[model samples]
Target chain A: MNEYTYPIIAGITVGTALRVFMLRTDYRQYPTYLHGKIIHLSLGFIAAALGTIAIPSIMEKEFTAVTFLTLAASQFREVRNMERNTLTEMDSYELVPRGNTYIEGIAVAFESRNYLVIFTSFVVTLCYLAINGWAALGAAFVCFVISSLLMSGSKLSDIVTVELSELSFKGAGLYVDNIYIMNIGLPERQDEILKYGMGFILTPKSFSVRSTIANLGQRQAILHDVSVTLGVFRDSGTPALVPLIKRDLNDGRIGVFILPQEKDPVRAKEIISSVPVLENAIQMPSRKRNREG
Target chain B: MKMEKAILAAITTQSEKVTGSTAVFHCETKEEMEAVAANLEAILDGIAHALSDRLYIIVKH
Candidate 1:
C-alpha cells in the first residue's frame, strides 16, 4: 500500500472505532433504528476523514482545505441540538423521565464524542506521519483508552455518603431518619408507601457537597435516574406517587423518598451513589466565605 | 385515624365554614404534605363510595 494511504486508513479506522465505542445502547434504547445509528456513524466517519486529511493537506501546503475543520465545528453544534430535541420529545412519554439537566448532559456528551473522534484521528495521523503505521496504531489505542477513562466524571459517592435509611410512617407522616419526608394521612396509602417505598439519606461530606445536592435540578436528576433504574409506582395524574428528594434545611442533608414498582434498597442506593455531580450544582460556600474573609 | 378519614371529617364537620376557600394544612416538611394528600384521597374515595358527587380540587404547596 502507498505510504500516504496507510496514514489515512489508520486515522479513519481508529477514529471511527473510538466514536462507536462511545455510542451506547442502554436501558433507554436511545438513537434507535437506521436514522439514529446512520447519521452519527456517517458524521463520525466524516469527522475522522477530515482529521486524517488535514495532516496531508498541510504537508502539501494546501492551507485552504483546513477551513473545512471550522465548518465541521459549526455542524457538530447542531448534533447537540439534534440530541437535545430528540430526548426532549421522548422525555414526555417516560415513566421516569430524565430531567432537563440530565438531558443536557446527554446532548453535550453526543456532541463531544464527535470531537473526540476527530482528536483521535488527528493523533493517529500525526503519529503515522512521524513513525511507522504499526507504532502509530499502538499509540492511538493507548490514546483511546486514556480518553475513555477521562470521560468518566466524578460520581456522587466522591462528594457525599449515600446510606439506606429506614422508610417509616408516623400516622400519616413519613420519616427517613428524622428528616420528615412527608405525611400520608390515608392509612391505605401509608400502608402501600411503607410496603413499596424506599428511602436514602445523602450525607454530604462538606459544605460544597451539601450545596451541590441542594440544587433542585440535581435532586430531580437523581429521582429521574432512580425511577428509570427501578421503575416508578405512579401512573399519570398520580402526583403524590412521584419520588421526592427533600433537603434538610438545618444541615443540608438530602432525603430521597421513592416508591418504585420493585422495592430494591440496594439498587436504589447504588443508582443514587453513581449519579453524576452536575456541573452547575457544585457550590463552594465555605470556600467563597473563606476567600471573602 | 387515616389521612383520608381525617380530611373527610375536617371537610364534613366544617362544610358551613369552609364555603369555597381551600382548607390549607401546613406541615413544616414534606411528610406533612404527603399525609395531607393521603388523607384527602381517602376522604374522596369514601365520598365516592357513599354515592355523593361533591367534588373538591386537591392541590399541594
Candidate 2:
C-alpha cells in the first residue's frame, strides 16, 4: 500500500498537468499527423503506476532498462514524424533566399522555450526517486511533472515562409518587367551554335515563359517569326563588312528571336521594319561594341 | 521486428496508395531495429487510423 500510494499520485499529477498544458498552449494548432506527446505522457503515467504497485516485491535494479529505452524511442519516433510532416508541407511553396533563415530562427526559438521546462521536469523526477525510496506517490509526482512539461513543449514551432523575388527573366525588343521569353533558332543547326557559343539556349526544346501571373496575367499562345541582321567591320587595311541575319518572334514589347551565323541583309531589314518600334529595337551594335572592348 | 510489422500492417490497412510514400527509420544496430519493430507492432497491432492516400517508409540505416 505504501509503495503504491506514491507512484499513483505521481502518475496522476503528471498525466493531469500534461493534459492541462496541451489544452492551454497553441501547440495544438500545428499540423502534424503524429500524436507522439500523448503517447509519451500516457506511457509515463503507466510506468509510474506500475512502479509503485510493484515496488515492495521488486528491487530497483530488477527493472529492465529496455523498457525505458523503448518508451524513449517511441517519443523520438513521434518527433521525427512531426518534423517530416512539416518539411514535406514546406516543399510545396516557392521560398526566397532568406526564407530558410527565418525558418531556422523560428525553430531555435521554439526549442529554447520548451527545453527549460523539459529539463526541469526530468530533474524533479530523478530527485524524487532518489529521496523517496521506490514509493508510488513520489514516482507518480515525478512522472506527472515530466509528462506535463514534455506535452506542453512538443509543438512549439511550425511555420513556413515564402518569398516572391526570384522570378525575373529577359525578353527581346522591350524591357518588360517580370517576364520570361524563350528563343528557338531556325534550320535546327543554329541550335548547336547557340547552345555551345551563346548562353541564351535552354534545354528541353521549348520556349521559356515566366511562371508569374502578375507579369503576363494570361498565357500567350501565338508564335511569331521575324528576322534581323548584324553588321560587323573587319580591321583589315580597309574596312571589310560582314552581315548576319536571325529569325525570331515579336510580341509587341517582348521578342523571342534566334540568330543564324550567315548574313541576309534583305531579310533582316524586312523583319526589323515589322517590329512596332524598329529604331529603338536594334541593340546589336551596342552589344558588339561592349564585347569588342 | 514487431513494431515494424505493426507499422506496415497499419499502413497497409489504412491506404492502398502507398507506392511512392516512404518510411524512414534510424537504426544503428540490429538490436535497435528489433526494438523499434516491437514498439511499432504494439501501436499498429489492432488499432485503426486514417491512412493517407500514399504512405511509404525510407529506412535511414
Candidate 3:
C-alpha cells in the first residue's frame, strides 16, 4: 500500500474510536437500543472517512476536495434534525417528559460531536502524514481530552444548592418548604402523596443563576432526569400525582415535588445535583444589568 | 385560543355556592360531596379543588 493509505486508516480508526468512547448508553437512556447505536456508529465512520481523505487530497494539490467538508456540515445538521424528531415523538409517552430545551440540547450535542469526530480525524491524519505515527497517537490523545472537555456542559450543582425539604400540606395545598406546589382536594390522594412524595428545594448560588433555574424547561429537565433514575410513582389517569416544580418569587428559590417509587431522599438529592444544566435554559440577566449600569 | 384550564364539574353541598357555565352536582352531605368530587376527578381526568367546606370543583389542567 501507499504512504497515504496507512495514514488514512490510522485517522479513521482514531476518529471512530473517539466516537465510540463518546457514545455512552448512560442513565439518559438515549442510544441505548442496538439500532440507535448502529446508526450513530455508521455516521461516525462516514465522518471519519470524510475527515481522513481531506488531508491526502490537499497534499495531492486537489483543492476542490476541501468542498466536501461543507457537505459534511449539512449531513451532520440532518443528524441533529433526526435526533430532535425522534426524541420529541417519544417524549409524549414519557411519565416525566424531557422538555423541548433538553431535546434541542441533545440534538445539538449529536451534531457538534460529529464535527468533533471530523476534527479529530483531520488532526490525526495531518500529524501522521506530516510527521510520524507516534506523533499522530499523541495528537489523538490530546484530541480526546479536548473533545470531552468541550462536550460536557455544567451540572445543576455548579449553579444551585440542592437540599431535601419536608413535604407538608396546608389544608389541601402541597407545600415544599415555604413554596406552595399544588392543591389536592381528595384526602385519599393527599394521603397517597404524603406516603410517596419527596420534596427538594434548589437555591440559586448567584443572582444570574436564579433566572436560569427558574426556566420552565430547566425545571422539567430536572424532574424528568430524577423520575427516569429513581422510577416515578405515577401512571396514566392520575394527573393529581404528577411531579411539579414551583418557584419562590421572594428568594428566587425553587421547590421540587416528586413522587418516586423508591423513597430514598439521599439518592434523589444526588440525582438532582447531577442533572445537567440545559444550554438553552441558561439566562444571564445580571450580565446585561451590569453592562447597562 | 384554546382554554388551558376549565372547571369540568362542581360538586357542592351548598346549592347557592357555584354558578356559571360548568356542570354542578349538588350532594346531600359533605361525605357525598367528597365522593362525588373524587369520582368526577377520576372520570373527568381532572383535579378537584375545594373552594370551601361545602364546594369542590373539578378542573382540567
Candidate 4:
C-alpha cells in the first residue's frame, strides 16, 4: 500500500464512525430532516473511501489535494446545512414570553482546531509528496484526532437553549416570526429565561410601564397618576421624617401609579407628610419596603 | 403534555421565519420539555469536554 493509502483508510474509518454516532444518538432531539442527513453523511464516507481507493495518480501531490478538497467541501456543506436548519427551527418560536411559552437562541462557534487540522492535512499531503511518503499518512491520523476532538468539543456547547415556563399560562404559544438573535449574550442565561421566563414587548412611549407590568405579572395594584415620596435611608439611622419626594410617581403603594412626568416637589412633599407609613400602604407593602427602614 | 406539544408545534412552524433554520421537535409537556432539556444539557457538556480536549491537542501541537 502506498503512503496515501493508510491515511485515506484512516480518514474513512474515523469519518464513518462519526457519521454512525450522529445517526444513532438521539435523532429525536434533532428535527425530522436530520434523519436524511444522517444517511447522507454515511453515504459521503463511502464515497470518500471509494474515491481514494479507485483514483490512481503518479504525482501523489495532485491526488492528495483533490481528495482533501473534496472531503473538506462535503463536510463544510454538512455543517452549513445543519446550522441553517437549526436557525430555521429557532425561528418558529415566539421568543418573547406572553403567557407560559418561552424561547431562546443557541450560539454555536466554529472550532478553530478543525481549521487547524484542515490546514495540517493540506500541509501533510504536500509533505508526503516530498520527503517521507509515509509521513503524510501519520499527519492525516493526527488531523483526524484533532478534528474529532474539535467536532466533539466546545462547538457543541454553543447550541442555543429555548424554553417555555408554566405550560398552562394563557397565550403561551409559539409564534412563527421570532428568530434567534446571535452573538448577543451568554446562551446559558438566555436558556434560563427561556425555560422559566416571562416577557412583554412595548412601544417606545410605554416601554418602562410595560416592563413594570411584565415584571409584576397579574399582581394586584392600583394605578395612579400622582407622585409619591421615596426615602433612601442608611441602614443604621432612622429615616428622615421628611422623605425625599418625587412627584407623579406610580409607586405601587398608592396603587399602580404611572407618573407621566417628574412629580411636583410641593405636591410630593404634601402627600408624604399626610400619608401614614403603616396605615394606607397596601398589604405586605412593609415586607416590600427596605428592611433597614 | 398536550399544551407543551402545541407550543412546540407552534414554535416549529414559526421557527423557519424567526431563526432561518429548520425547527426540530417540540416539547409538548413539562416532562417532555424536561427530558429534552436534560438531553441537551448532556450534549452541551459532552461538547464542552470535547472542545477542551481539542484545545489541549492544539496547544500540544
Candidate 5:
C-alpha cells in the first residue's frame, strides 16, 4: 500500500514484543493466569498501535493525531488501578499478605511498562520514517536495553546485609539477635514456634538506608516474599505462629522472625536479600541532612 | 469505634491479680489456667499473653 505501511507494522511488532518481554511472570507470579496474560497482551497491542500511528500522522501533516497520546496516558492509568484492585483483593487470602506498598509498587510498574512500550514504538517508527528499516531495528534494541535498566530497582542486598540470627526465648518474649519480637504465653505454642521458626538480622549498610529498611511496608514485603518462596508454616486459626519484624532501637538493625516450612537458612537468606526494595517505601533522609549542613 | 485489641478474658490462678471489665476465669492451678487460656485463644482467635506466673490474658490483636 503506502510507504508508511511497512514501518508501522515493524514498529507495532517491536513494541508488542517489548511488552511481552516485560510482562514476564517471575517469582511474583502476577499476570500468570491465561485471562490476565490475555488482558495485558491486548492492552500492549493497543499501546503499540497508538505509538506507531503517531509518526505517520505527523509526517502527513495531521498534527492533531498526536493528541491521542493523552488518551493513552489515562488508559495506562486505568491499568494501574486494575492491577491495584486485583492484587488488593487477592492479598487478604494470602498466607502472608503483600502489604499496600508492595501492591502499589507493582501497579506502578505495570503502568510504566505500557508507557515504555509506547516510547519504544514511537522511536522505532520515527527511525523508519526518517532513515531506514535497519536503523529502526537498532533503535528498538537500544530501547529494550534502556527499558530493562529502568525497570530494575535496587534490591535489599544493595542497601543491607542479611545475616542469620539465633531465635531464642527470653522468658515469654521471642528474641531475634537481641530484638524482642513478641510474647507467646503458651508453652505448646512456644514449642511449635521454636521448632519451626527462623531468625535473621538485617544490618543497614549506610545511615540513610537505616530508615528505608525500617519502613513497615518494606518489612512486610520481605515476609511476604519469603513466605511465598519458602512456604509459611501457619494457618488462619494460629495467630501466634506468625512472622514478625522488630527493630533494635539501639542500632538500626532489624530482626526478621519467620515460620517457614522449608528450613533452609541459605535459601531463606538468599530470598530475603533478593526482595525488591519497594519504591514507595524508599526514604533518603541523608540527602536533606546534607543540604542543611 | 472498632476495637483492634481488647482483653477478651483473663485466665488466672490468682483471681485477686486481675479485676474489672473483662471476664476472669479463676483456676485452681497453673496447668489448669494454661489449658483454659489455650482453648479460649483458639476459640476467640486471640493471643495468650502471660502477665505473670499466675496470670494469662487472651488479647485480641
Candidate 6:
C-alpha cells in the first residue's frame, strides 16, 4: 500500500464522524423524522468521500477527478432548495408560521454543514500528508472543535436581555410592558387570553440590537421558536391565538405575546435567549454613521 | 351584552351598505371591532373584545 493510503483513510474516518455529529433535531424539531436524517447523513458521507479523495487525485495528476468537487457544490445547493421547499410547505399549516427568513436560515445551515464536512476532511488529509499519523489524529481533534464552532454562530443572548413581562389589557388593546399589541375582542376570548397568555420583553443593549429585534422577520422568528418550544394555544382559523411581537414606538423595545398551551415564563425566556439572530435582520447603523463621517 | 359571529357574518355580507352609512367612529384607537362598528353603521353601536387581539363588531341588524 502507498504512504498516502492511511492519510485518505484517516480523513474519511474523521470527516464522516464529524458529519454524523452534526445530525441533531434539537429545540427546532426540524428534519423531524428519521427519513430526513437519513437523507442528510447520506449526503454528508458523499461530501466527506469527495473531500478525502481530492488531494490524492491531484497528487496522482488525475485532473479530471477534481471536477467532482464542483459537481458536489451544485448538489449541496439543490439540498438547500429542497429543505426550503419542504419547510415552506409545512409552514403554511403552522399556527405561528416561521417566516421565510427563518426557513431560509435553516436551509442555509444544513447546506453549510455539508461543506463543513468537506472542509474538515480536506484539512485533516492535508495535515496527514504533511506529518505522521499520530500527530495528524491530534490535529484532527482540534479541527473538529473548530468546525463545530463555525457552525454554532452567535445567539440572541449576546445582544439582548430577555425576561418575563406583565401581560395586561388596556381597554381593548393588549399590552406587554406598555407595548401596544393588537386589540382583543370577545369576552370569553379575553378570558382565555388572561388564562394562558404569557409575555416576554426583549430589551436591546444597543441601537443595532434594537433594530435587529425591531425587524419583523426577527420578531416572527422569536415567536416561532418560543411557540415551537412551548406549545401554541392555537389552531388553524383561529387568528386570535396568533403570537404577536410589537415594538415600543418611543424606545424601540420589543414585546412578545403568546398564548402558549404551557405557560412557563422561565422556559419562554430561555427559548428567546437561545434564538439565533437573523443574519439578514442585523442592522449596523453605526457602520453608516462611520461612513458619513 | 356579547357580540356573536353571526352578526359579523351579516355585517361582512352587508359591507357595501355599511360603507355608505355615515362613519362616526366611537373609539379612534384603531381597534378592528371599532372599525367594524364604524363600517356596519354610522352610530358606534358597541365594542366587544375577543380572543386576545381579535376584534369583533356585533350589530343588532
lDDT minimum window of 10 residues, candidate 5 chain B: B10-19
Candidate 5 docking class: high
Shift in Å, residue A240, candidate 3 = 0.2
Model 2, span A49-150: residue lDDT tens? 333333322445555642653554455445445444564466344111112222333333333323322333343344444565354345445655654554
- Model 3 clash pairs are none
Count clashing residue pairs in model 3: 0
Best by DockQ: 5
| Pairs that collide, model 5 | none
- Where does candidate 4 stray beyond 4 Å? A1-7, A19-28, A31-34, A43-75, A78-82, A86-145, A152-293, B1-61
- lDDT comparing candidate 3 with the true structure: 0.94
Reference-based lDDT, each prediction = 0.76, 0.31, 0.94, 0.32, 0.94, 0.78
Docking class of 4: incorrect
Least accurate stretch of 10 residues (summed lDDT) in model 6 chain A? A182-191
The 10-residue segment of model 4 chain A with minimum total lDDT is A97-106
User: Given the true complex, what DockQ would model 3 score?
Assistant: 0.79
Clashes in model 6: which pairs?
A184-B49, A184-B50, A185-B49, A185-B50, A186-B49, A186-B50
Decoy 1 TM-score against native: 0.83
In candidate 1, chain A reaches a TM of: 0.93
What is model 2's DockQ versus the real complex? 0.01
Residue A29, candidate 4: how far off, in angstroms?
Answer: 1.3
For model 3, residues A252-271, the per-residue Cα lDDT tens digits are 99999999999999999999
How do the residues A1-293 of candidate 5 rate in per-residue lDDT, one tens digit apiece?
A: 88999999999999999999998988888988999999999999999999999999998999999999999999999999999999999999998999999999999999999999999999999999999999999999999999999999999999999999999988888999899999999999999988999999999999989899889999999999999999999998778888999999887999999999999999999999999999988999999988999
